[model samples]
Target: MLFDFDGPICHLFPGDTAKRVAEAQVRWLEERGLRDLLADGVREEPDPYKVLRAVDLRSPGSDLVAELEEHLTQQELGLVATAMPTAYVDPLIRTWSAVGARLAVTTNNSPRAVGRYLASRGLTECFAPHVYGRTPDLHLLKPHPHCVRRALDAMGAAPDETLMIGDAPSDHVAARAAGVRFLGYARNARKAERLRAAGATHLVGSLEPLLKVVYAVGDIKAR
Candidate 1:
């Protein structure tokens, strides 16, 4: 199984993002009298992407990334984490692993970022050391089947026998391209309709509800 890590496992940006770290950047800049940073007539309000855009003063790319990195380093950002194992996650994975369901993560994020978060959340022990990412396989992002195919190859599993469980359209598209089953993680009902339209085989919001499906009569790998 290939799982997308962000939304299902953690809330990186937090809530609607109105009062998140993105908002704090402007405040941080202002405190330092860097009000000139907002001289571009950029957003002073919280509009999700607007606050983020303002941080870069509307310019894009590595420039934006560098600025954000610098800002985060100076500020004490908040991170809400589970005190224990992510309740819905730990058992399901160990169960699946026992049942011989090979697991992998194929995300657009760099391996460093993934590793940092996983280690912080104490989730590093969940999988084998070979947690694959774009670092070694930048050629394939989630929208492409290259990474997914590679994961299956690593496990010696064929496409038809594999499954991709994720929260976005790229998950479905990649599964389709790789001929694997796509399980949509519609954790939010608001996005459920959209994922359905994208051709997801099953619409499940929580990882807790997936074990039955994994070992079920349907969709099992054929010998």
Candidate 2:
């Protein structure tokens, strides 16, 4: 099983932290006279990763992009303390691991941040080195399937046998590209609508149902 870090696992930024981070990134660029690098639409983006991607698109392979990516990573690392784990996800992850299911976290967030958060939750062993996250290569971020493919290769798992749970349309697109089954986790109506519009047919509003399924499977195996 492959999980997306920011949503299915935890809400990494909480309330307005992500928006503030994006604003800070813009300010950082403006201070360097690089504000023009961002398009009008991207300048106001609340997701720092999207802001980083916009800068990367304009100046790919530049020191400026690298620095900005690192800045975003630092902000993410700082937010880990206040990140909220999705309801039931801790138990869900634990139960899945206990049932002999191999788990990995594939995310656009920094691997360092993912590792720290998982370690804090005592979930490091559930995924460990199988965590594939953002690299210096901004283009590899999902909806690209790069991280998902990395997890599959490391685990020697087939795409057909793997399942990916993510909240975004990009996750859906990436899973389809990689030939993996996709399960959408939409915590709200707005999120559900967005996933539906992205052509995602299978979605859960919460992880509780999945937890129940895991319990049933475990019971069946034990019997």
Candidate 3:
């Protein structure tokens, strides 16, 4: 069995929310002339994720996040990507399925969000009835392992036969708690190191390296 989402199948889901938050922060900085205090030659298109994550930290007790969320609904936040599909995901799933691996998704995001993007990408039928999202599974969010456990149950997969790949620390941690091995899909190395610290058994900077895992090791070979 295989499990991976977020950076592998898609990029961060709240991309538009981050963009709005970054614009808001920039405006907030300019309003207070804080931009003037920065060193020279700092021009660059601001990364909305970094900008918003910083804001999220600066105002731990602030209602700003809720305010931001109110302005950016679930659908408003685009599931933007930093990379195109490394290879046709359908072939990978099909190959793995023939090798006896069942594929499924367990994401903290609302089920509708996944449906929305997959529908947009024309990749919905690939997963079949194996997606578990927060839409109706609110009680089983990530970092808790309930969703993954449910997936295992549905697949009739044992922990040893299951391999989880994800791009975040929570993804690996959740896999550990659910008793499975994990590979850190380090889409961004700096961020993925933190997940490594949390016990990601292996790291793949990009999906192109899957040939090594799926073919060479004969480990988790395509179904």
Candidate 4:
């Protein structure tokens, strides 16, 4: 199973707390006289990943882009203390692992941040050495299949046998590009609508349904 870290595993930012970081990145660019990188309303956009994407598109392969990405990664690492774990995520991870599933986190968030959270939650063993996340290259982040493809390659898992559960259209797109089954984990109606519009056929509002699936499979295995 390939789980997207931010939403499916936890609320990376509660109360849209990432806005400050996004604003900070914008401010950093502005201070460095890179104001031309700003798209309209970018300062007000809350998701730092989008900000990074904007900067990356305008300044790919530049040292400044690397600096900005590192800055954002630091911001993400700093925010891990307040990140809320998604309901049932810990047990779901443990249960799947117990049932012989090889899980990997495929996220746009920094792998270090994901590792920090998992280590804190004692989930490190559940997905050791398979956490594929942001690299220094911002363009590789999802909406591109780089991370997902990396995870699949690392696991030596076939696309037909893999499943990708994530909360965004980018996840859907990445999964499709990798030829993996896509499961949309929409926490609300707005997200559900977006996934639907993106052509996601498998949608779940919560992990509760997946828990049942996991337990059922485990039960059969035990039998």
**Model 3 residue 155 lDDT score:** 79
The root-mean-square deviation over C-alpha atoms between each candidate and the true structure, in angstroms, is 5.9, 0.8, 7.1, 1.2
All candidates: TM-score: 0.63, 0.98, 0.64, 0.96
lDDT of 4 by residue, 34-148 (tens): 9789788876789888988888888887898889888988888887888889998889999999999999999999999999999989999999999999998777889899998
The best candidate in terms of lDDT: 2
Candidate 1 lDDT trough over 10 residues, lowest sum: 75-84
lDDT of 1 by residue, 55-152 (tens): 44434444543555445433322343332233376556656666666777766544555566677755566656546655322235567777677778
Write down the worst ten-residue block by lDDT for model 3: 36-45
Error of 1 at 75 (Å): 11
- Look at candidate 2 and tell me the lDDT of residue 11: 96
Please list all clashing residue pairs in model 3, or write none if there are none. Answer: 96-222, 96-223, 97-223, 98-223, 99-222, 99-223, 100-223
* True lDDT of residue 106, candidate 2: 92
The TM-score between candidate 1 and the true structure equals: 0.63
lDDT of 1 at 23: 62
| Full-model lDDT for every candidate | 0.61, 0.95, 0.60, 0.91
lDDT of 3 at 83: 24
lDDT-best of 1 and 4: 4
